[model samples]
Target: MAAALLGGGDYELQVSLSEALCRLTPRKDREQRTNQWFSSRDVSRAFCDIQDRDFEVDCRHFLNYVNRCHGDQRRVHTFPCLRAFLDSTELFPPKDEKLEKFWVDFNQTSECLSFFTDDPQVPSLT
Candidate 1:
């Protein structure tokens, strides 16, 4: 799956993740405004790391970080699939008013991709 994404064979996942992050962490007018940051390099590193380590654990930790930042009102974003997984499993941390605002704003952003309907057929990393 990672290979397919990185190799350009899985553009849908790439697009979905990218759109999700942007929605979750829109850049502020000024720099150093938010705690969330992401890039292709970070995603690639995370993907490779997950391939070698415990994907569930890594994903949990990663999502926790993202949720924490969101709660803290930090301007950060993470992978959409991770967020979706967290939402589905109720794994997100206790809600905070500040984070709720971020979540709402994040959700308001345009959705550029849809993993829910794209039919990602990759094998589970576990």
Candidate 2:
């Protein structure tokens, strides 16, 4: 499951896995069978649309996807994009100690948007 997610394979497969997990655990609600099917083009369109400045549109699209899947289902595979969106919007639970540690590690490892040093024409801010 992790491999499929990391490899960017069929996202529906991930959603199916999540549904299976939910069935096994029996969360608050049963698995929703909404239009869970998505093609690569659909994903691409969603990816582009999410970048829109209108938060309402973005949130609606995101919630539509989430609602299509069973909420609180352990087996439901959450896309990394959803996780990122939730994190950035502070929509999820409050960040705990572990989350804080994750942020620290992520910030340390990820690249920052800084000016390149090779541009000789531009004066160095430092």
Candidate 3:
């Protein structure tokens, strides 16, 4: 099973499988799952070690998902993922200002505090 290979210590396979899983996920639940995967500490750290091509694929998927989330009026739950990615990536800030602006606006919204303040009611997907 592909899930079993996740612990095989293969970075390339991990990246591929992670992307494939997200792509194959049902549309109705894709956003939450995608956010969970990227926000996972181990997965996020492993992504930083993958090849450029694989990294780009993951980045593209995240960007597309964010766009869809916004257009569908869905809440964005990948702030931790984005933060981790930014921390892992060196120099050369993201060119997309929209993403930056969205984060800024999103922070002003009431739900932003939940991301920092841990609540027992908010179940973590990770």
Q: Which rank order by lDDT, best down to worst?
A: 3, 1, 2
What tens-digit string does per-residue lDDT give for candidate 3 at 20-62? 6645665566545544656455444443333335544444344
Q: Best to worst by TM-score, what's the order?
A: 3, 1, 2
Against the reference, the lDDT scores of all candidates come to 0.34, 0.31, 0.38
TM-score of each: 0.23, 0.21, 0.26
On TM-score, the leading prediction is 3
Relative to the unseen true structure, what is the Cα RMSD of model 2? 15.8
TM-score: the better of candidates 2 and 3: 3
Residue 25's lDDT within candidate 3 is 65
Measured by lDDT, the strongest candidate is 3
Per-residue alpha-carbon lDDT of candidate 1 for residues 10-124, written as tens digits (9 for 90 to 100):
3344344434443444344212212223334444334333322343344434343433433544332334333434334433332333232112112213343222222234445
Writing each residue's lDDT as its tens digit, candidate 2 over 30-122 gives 222211333344443442343224433343344335333434432223222222233343223233332221110111112221110122345
Q: State in Å the error of residue 24, model 3.
A: 0.9
Question: Where does candidate 3 have its weakest 10-residue lDDT segment?
Answer: 101-110
| lDDT at 17, model 2 | 44
Looking at candidate 2, the ten consecutive residues that score lowest on lDDT are 100-109
User: Would you list the clashing residue pairs of candidate 2?
Assistant: 18-75, 18-76
